[model samples]
Target chain A: MTTTEKIRGLILKVAKGKLSQEALKPEARLSEELGLDSLAQSELLVLAEDSFGIKFTHDEVWTVATIGQMVEVIDSRLAAK
Target chain B: MRQSAGILGTGACLPEQVLTNLELAERFGVTPDWIFERTGIVQRHIAAPEQACSDLAIAAARQAMENAATAPEEIGMVIVATITGDYTTPATAAIVQGVLGIPAVACFDLSAACSGFVYGMIVGSHAISCGFCNKVLVVGSEVLSRFTNQTDRDSAILFGDGAGAVVLGGVPEGYGLLATDAGTCGTEYQAIIIPAGGSRLPPSAETIAAHLHYSHMDGNQVFMFAMRVLGNSTLRTIEKAGLSLDDISLIIPHQANRRIIEAAAGRMELPLSKIVINLEQIGNTSSASIPIALHGVLTDGRIRHGDRLVLTGFGGGVSWGSALIRWHSPGSDQIHKKEKNDDNN
Candidate 1:
């Protein structure tokens, strides 16, 4: 699968299918468009960490916004190590 | 092959006085529901004016000895885990040793904040496994009510006074501690701290006026740190033991907040029914949380011989730890079964 496909899969899983098709766009804001709260974001980060075996710090997690941004951050974290 | 040390028995002591959330709400000018919503605390025990941390520790230690059928002379060490010890000069374990008349036994104390009990188990287990001692008494005792700012709702509502203890001795190899892990992030040292009364900022009239003696917490930061570390350390410890998640029967986490534990459990994919929680009855007893909860669950027979239980906690050193223990109560031993049967009759 492509990077976009993998990222979309994670977003869907973390959001519990709450994200609409339109919200799947790379530029869609995660919190504003999909209503993921802080706790949900933390859980999402945990899922990402476990799935990819890559960790993100608290500051890195807070800066995440769009689904595209989360994918980029995960990619960067995975690459950094 | 390392000798294995497991908990022989457990005991706990909470102060007689009960302070309900309604009472604290009246004092703090917040509704009881508001307090409950945030902290999940119903009532907490407060130490009396005459009571010290050692007083509670002695009571708890005695009970643990009785339960373990361990004579005072057989215990080669007494280790106390606490921040609110009886005195800063003489270790609180030394005081307990004196009171129990267990002469010449090694005694000391260590500070790991709320994670003290987990840390104690690691040390006590090592002591027995290394043949440094035949038996060890490990106690987590705290008089947090004394350090709490009566008017600071953030911390006052979260602390209580209590102690819990366990007798540690050899269990059959392979049925005791499987794995243990611990870590400290000193960079976050100030996440939960009392700014004064240490050598760096010794007590003074000015400090008292400033109320620098009371505990302070960065609640948001601590919550995030707690949720992240609690599950991570537990899973890591379990994996290190060469066991999978399916092998775990119970998880006794630090009884800090219901939401923090629940959130971490969700992240870890562990069910709520598998976790032990007692903060509603005792509030946050800091180092005493895990042992008191352990004692509670053990008393009610929620745990049994050969059951694998994970004990995990995080606290004020910016510290956290986990220890995997296969339960082995003394009463379950064949040598004690006859005595236990007679006593039951």
Candidate 2:
């Protein structure tokens, strides 16, 4: 799956029944649109680490605010690896 | 010529499930001894899945009434001190009163965190003295196990599910509740709290996934605060009671941790023997701690008639309180009868 597709899937999985594909667009505001809070945001980071098999630091979690930015970061990290 | 309010009875109830430090250590990858050395907690009670905070409160309140030979109807007021109420709106005290069939009493809940029971006593005593009520039921109950994060080792080992209660009634001149002091500092609210689930951050799927409903704490900061406040508050209350620390026959402080309790005792220059310590089995039952310790002390026959005692507590909301009281009808082996035989008869 593409990085964006993977990030979207992770958000939906962690949120379980809350978030779906239609609601979690790449350009959408995760907090405003999908209603993710800090705790949920942390859970997304954990899910991303598991899905992409890359560890992200707390500071890195702060830098990636949206699904699109997170995809870019993950793709670059995977590319580097 | 201050009217006194003596503790007529005391009782405590712990949930059936007992969680030992060893069990918790295996889950957290820490040594059992490490948990004991740091927190002095050996085991803690865990509520049944279906149980709520009011359930424990009812149990404790019932026992207190039974011990005092007081009927449910005689209880003019009920005060429940808790942070983990069954609902956010209706006071847990009301539910407890309903369950106990004490419909005539006015009931409410106080949220001074762990210091609640002492605060409740202060409020109850004042109401009694002011002729607002005669018999008051003060209970501290918590189902902290329900709000605890299983994965958070720092907090998981330090809290338990339980309730403690005391019945306070008006007594003759100079014999019941002498003096009490209560205070709070909202600035330290962040030191221990449930971050979400309030108006500030209402619960959502996000909150659930993040476990925002769970309890959180800055242990080091709270420890420092507890050590400082516990002793300071006790001394302040003692001074206000027009007595010296030496006049206190027994000191009952919040059972947050052994280290904090011992440090406070040391600072007060009170010997370990004079302080009630039960954290080894109960952990920190928050507001329930003081009354539980009081019940234990009474049951053990440590307190005597006319013995002066100091009760103090410090906990979340940065709340703290202390009260000096003289034991009445102490050392009497009046077996607390649970059955409601009319005291008039």
Candidate 3:
């Protein structure tokens, strides 16, 4: 699948397998709209590392905001790989 | 193969002062929803300024002894598991022993952070099985509120003060402690730590200014370690006990975070209902989590005769442990009698 599809799947998993389909849109604000708290944000980073087989620093993981930003981070890591 | 120690009774003592999520949110300048969503804690008990680990231990131990129909002189060993002892020098068990009037029997402190209580149970049971002790009092108490850095929202929002205890004694054959699995990944010791006030750094004015005495944690690292170790230890203990996952009646894990516990339950393929969790009522109480959660389940009548249970924990020391037990109360018949007597008197 494309990077976008993979990112969407990861977002759903991070949301505990429940979220509106529209919430996966690139422009969706993860904090304001999806409600990922600091703890959840950390968890998402850990999960993202595992899912993409890429590494992220704690700050890198916790700092990403919108779905588009997270996707971009993942895409960059993938390209580097 | 060896003498199995039975859980005679369990008692918990949570301080009277309750700190609510809303109050913590206001103190940390965060939304109440953020606190709840992050830690799954609704409220936590705060110890009074004068209260110490030994104080809570005495209260909980008294209740446990009474529940076991055991007098002070009958206890042959007192084992306390704590990370927040009143002092780092004298063992907290000695203080508890003195206050409980349990004579000069064996007394000591064991520190494995959140895994301390589960570790204590194994040590206490080994003492019993080796014929060195017949009755042991195992208490896990912590006054973490004192050590918590009120300014650090990450660490501050997740801890509370409380104590829990259990009396260990002989039980009927086939119904007692079955097996235990304990581990420590010391390499990750830096994951959750208090940076100073030890031999490594010693106490200094600079250290004090830096507030190095307070806990510092890598939340991401701890969360990863706990989720990985908790479920695996539970499975290993059950396997060691010659039982399967289906045989488990309940799993009581260290009450550090609700999300970690939920992930562990899922990994174990057990429903959340099968796990005993009281963190929502009393934020992470360190070593007290297992006993506190155990007491919660026991009092609710969720643990019954012949049921299998696993008490698992993971925390500082980068440690983890699990103890499996086949439930059978040694002094169950006395619980009601004591309750009625308490009512009458």
Better of 2 and 3 by TM-score: 3
On DockQ, the leading prediction is 3
Look at candidate 3 and give me any clashing residue pairs.
none
The TM-score, computed over Cα atoms with residue i paired to residue i, of candidate 2 is 0.77
Residue range B2-68, candidate 3, lDDT tens digits: 7778899888999999888888889988898888877889988999999999999999999889878
Query: For candidate 3, what is the lDDT?
Result: 0.85
lDDT of 2 by residue, B1-345 (tens): 445677888888999999999999999998999888768899999999999999999999888888888888889999999999999979998899888989667899999998899989999998888888888999999999888998899889899999999999877787888888889989878989898999999999999899999998866557656766887788888888889867888999999988678655654567888788999999999999999999988876677778899899998988899989887872223422211132434
Q: TM-scores, in order shown?
A: 0.84, 0.77, 0.88
In model 2, which residue pairs have backbone atoms overlapping below 3 Å?
A: B5-B176, B5-B177, B6-B176
Please give, for residues B225-332, the per-residue lDDT of candidate 1 as tens digits.
888899899999999999987888899998888767887887778888889989898999988888899888877667767889999989897999999998875742
> What DockQ, between 0 and 1, does each candidate earn?
0.20, 0.01, 0.32
True contacts kept of each: 0.11, 0.00, 0.21
The lDDT of each candidate is: 0.85, 0.83, 0.85
Runs of candidate 3 with Cα error greater than 4 angstroms are A1-7, A17-35, A45-81, B332-345
